[model samples]
Target chain A: MVAENKGIEPGGGIVLDGISHAYSGRKALDNVSLTVPRGESMALLGPNGAGKSTLLNILCGLIRPDAGRAIVAGVDVSKHSSEARQNIGVVFQDDSLDDRLSAWENLEFHGLVYGMDKPSRARRIDEVLALVELSEWAENPVRTFSGGMKRRLEIARALMHEPRILILDEPTVGLDAQTRAKIWSYLNQQRRERDLSVFVTTHYIEEAESCEAICVIDHGKVQVQGPPADLKARYGTSLIRCLPRSPEVRQKLLEKYPEAQRLSGDRLGIVVRDQAMIDAFLSEFGSSLKEILIDEPSLETVFLAITGREMRERDEVNSKARGKRNKRI
Target chain B: MSKLTILGRGIYAIWLREIMRSFRDRGQLIGGVSRPIIWLLILGIGLNPYFRGEIYGEVRFVIPFTYLQFLFPAVIVLNIMYTSILFAVSMIWDREFGFLREVLVSPLPKWAILFGKILGGSTVATMHGFLVLILARFADVTLGWDQVAWALVLMFLLSFGLTSFGVILAARVRSFEGFGVFSNTIILPLYFLSSSVFPLDPSLTRTQTAATYPEWLAMLVQINPITYAVDALRGALIGFNQFDPWIGPSIIGAGAVLFFFIALVDFKRQ
Candidate 1:
């Protein structure tokens, strides 16, 4: 047994070793092992059914892994979940705030649950309100707030205890691009200012790019793990798109650039290993092409390449499977 | 500072929040109080002539005050029991709304959450019970200071036991519909079978009727913690037979503690 610390220690991190979990013979997480170093922001990028939420729940001490051990802030979460949870903060995938309560009341009640004294709770509530940029609406009922506002409040609630390790499960799902970007900026700022270790699960490939490191998981297992840029450079190739003005023109272009992969609608995608290929393709077919696009391989492409399906499609399939499983039970 | 103090504070806050929310819900507060008031008035008046008789050379009093004096105390226990069950149903809503997860994940001990909810529901039950008693005073039932104090104590103990039982049921229940079925299957039967409405005379055929069901039901009533509570209230408000004076209240207290620990264990499993 490790001794409990009275205060935050430097270089505190999370380590999960050989963690496996099953629900009614269906494996949710399969021997997943990962580490998040102190002050490192890690993104868990996965298609649906990749066990991201399961892993987050384990780290947060909400669910016990059926096999192996998970340590958070030097405490084994499964064995000492209450004590372990004291050192960690989590924002669940679903909205966990009391909608009937005002924003300030919600924070106050959460602080009380964490055993904060009145003075400390009041001060911390003010600080967190400012941190989430909701000081103006702190007294307003949470039900009246927009989705983005509610999500921000949930983040603020998690930060009330000043946890050393923060775990967020799909924090920005179903949000507008602008709101997502704002939340991303706030998280980045917090990371730099507090040097807090953050573990996040996100389906959005663009959000994954902002993390210091990324772990791509598929089918309840980690497929690849590394820095985002490094993973993209390793697994991703640049793609060139070409669009012909007419059907006859498109057929001719397709014959000419037989290497190009046809995307969903009227777009032709071609892998460009070097700038010479782009120049040659443009010079040869520049007259017939109505539009052209060039981009690096995205997180979506990396997921498709590794998982053999798009993230959205995988989510639909997983939901159907879950519905069937629920019916059987 | 210590785990105990942390738990204490958590329970206090949760209890306070529940009270505040219950008061805010106008329909719940009004319905909780009014249901018992209506029962006391309508049933007490309607059954007054029916209970007029002499049994075992003792004169039978009318229903409202005479019968109500006996029934009112039981109604107080019933009020607490019913309200606690209703509060348990609200737990289903809490589960669906994601609030239960928040409470479970708090740093406080899991038992604290269970006790907090039990305390909250019991407090509401006690309040409603008191309202019925005060309204009974207007219905011509006289009570001294000692009787009122004793009645309050018994009401508190009864609420604690019933609330603990409700907590145990709530933890086991999965859905609102399931809780509804349980409420119908358990609450009504417990109310009718117990010596709530009429006196328990071993010679009465009604007593025989209670005996015909099962040993468990008879034993439950014989040991029915609520039976002692009703007896204590009857002895205080109306002139009724009191048996095993100290043993009854003591047993009810013991039962409350037992049920509370059982509910706590169930909460930990959840």
Candidate 2:
């Protein structure tokens, strides 16, 4: 069976099977299985508490799963964690660079730790610094860099050893639009140039669209997994917004097209099943419609449909629970 | 390179990084050495007359040596304890900042990381100890070759033992505040209770004090590596041999090895 699995992909990638993890009796991951093929960028998309970070930790050999196996670059991460880690590079969500150390020193130290020789370490440090557009800042202390620069340095540090598989956990959580785009461009370019297998987790739906494939996870399980276009094509529909100006008009519109899902206040929403049904209803009450907007279903909607809660709502709820627990203590 | 060689290189790389970090924070490095330097200067000067004053018809001697004689060993041990505790604080900060996870995830063995940290902290401690010694010499403290060798050896062993103890405490602590509490509750008591400052004589009252506590305390002091460390320094610096001629150094060497092993085990479990 192992040989058969290996035959499916001749080169390096990651495979997670039946991975389960828990923290303090609360299940963080429930039988999560994912296969990231060679040379493909897979985006693990989820809201908070969806176990994306936990799964990434398992893939990176930082934590062991209670039940399941992770194979990274043909090495079992759980059984041969050290070897597996050697073949992979991880960029954590939080900044892990030594603030006091200069960028060059940081890269040099990490390269040496990865067992790179002095010459290669120096050469590769230069290469990665250029790759991340941090060549000029390489001699400056990391503490002096901006948030975006620090993030770029972190990526440079991770890539110093030239690992085949790169794992980035929430890589662009707090960055300006331009900086995020810059990082995305660099990552995509690097992937193309090196044929690297990239595994990234993100809360931003826009970021998810760039991945070759995406896995939408909610509450520790995958809600939908496929190529970006396919997932959107399968579940997406033209959104129709009809501002009826009153609850009575909203009720009448809902009654008219009962199949159309009521998104918010009966005015702004999408018809997931059929577009013509919305068209016919709009024709009947076309003049009454204050405004009409149409677009394909977003990952946000997919998350809502799967988890039965909005992303921000869930975060607010979690924060409240955490606050209450903290207060109680 | 072989795996072990790679591991060793990784450990050295981390150790060098730690040393560089310590030096980069000039204020902290300077401040870490300042307290002991002041103690050496002020206390050594103020208490010299008291030690020379006659007591009970016997001329009390402050061991009849330079100020460094009294302060050198104590300062070295104190440097080890202080620097190791500071390293523990950095370890706690690393935990908060998520760097510990990065180190833990690396291919380097856990023991290498722990021992690397201990060695790194010890190196800083040893350097600080030597700096104080150099300063002491400038203050007219004469040192023979034997005394210098004994001080160097004692400095290294004391550093190793105290750093190992610091690692154990760091591995067990969850927060900086918790570490502070541990340092205050444990470090100060250990320093004072031991013979680092005063002599441990077999006088009836002192024996009674040792007896009332857990046997380990007195045994640990008698066998306490620091006791031998202090004794060794005393023998060299003041020409006073307080401990058993041969057994003291052996016990200290043995105990340091034991502490190192315990630290390694604790690190792995963590």
* Best TM-score among the predictions, by candidate number: 2
Q: Write the per-residue lDDT of candidate 2 for residues A1-329, one digit (tens) a residue.
A: 24546454644688888888899899999988888887789998777778888899889887889998998877889888788888888889998988878999889888878878888998998899999989998889888999999899888888778888999998987677688889888888888888889999876667777788989788788778889888766765444545676677778877766755555444545454586666576677777766665544765555556554444432443334224212120
Clashing residue pairs found in predicted model 2: B220-B224
Model 1 lDDT per residue over A92-194, tens place: 7888888878999899989988888899999999998898899999989998999999999988888888887888888988777777878877777777777
lDDT of 2: 0.74
Tell me the tens digit of each residue's lDDT in model 1 across B1-270.
887778788998888877877887798788778877777778866765666555577665533246556667777777777887778776767778888888777777777887788788888888988878887665567878888888788777778888888777888888888888888788777776667765555544353346445656667677655677666666656656446567657766886899899988877776
- Candidate 1 residue spans exceeding 4 A from truth: A1-11, A238-295, A313-329, B54-65, B203-229, B235-243, B246-251
Candidate with best DockQ: 2
Give the per-residue lDDT of model 2 (tens digit) for B1-270. 788778888989988977887888787678666866776777766655554434467765434544446655666666667776667777777778877777877787778888787788878877777777776564466777777887777677777777777777787888888887778787666666556655555552344356555666666667545566666656655565566656556655765688789988976765
The TM-scores of all predictions, comma-separated, are 0.83, 0.85
Model-by-model DockQ, in order: 0.63, 0.67
What lDDT score belongs to each candidate, Candidate 1 first? 0.76, 0.74
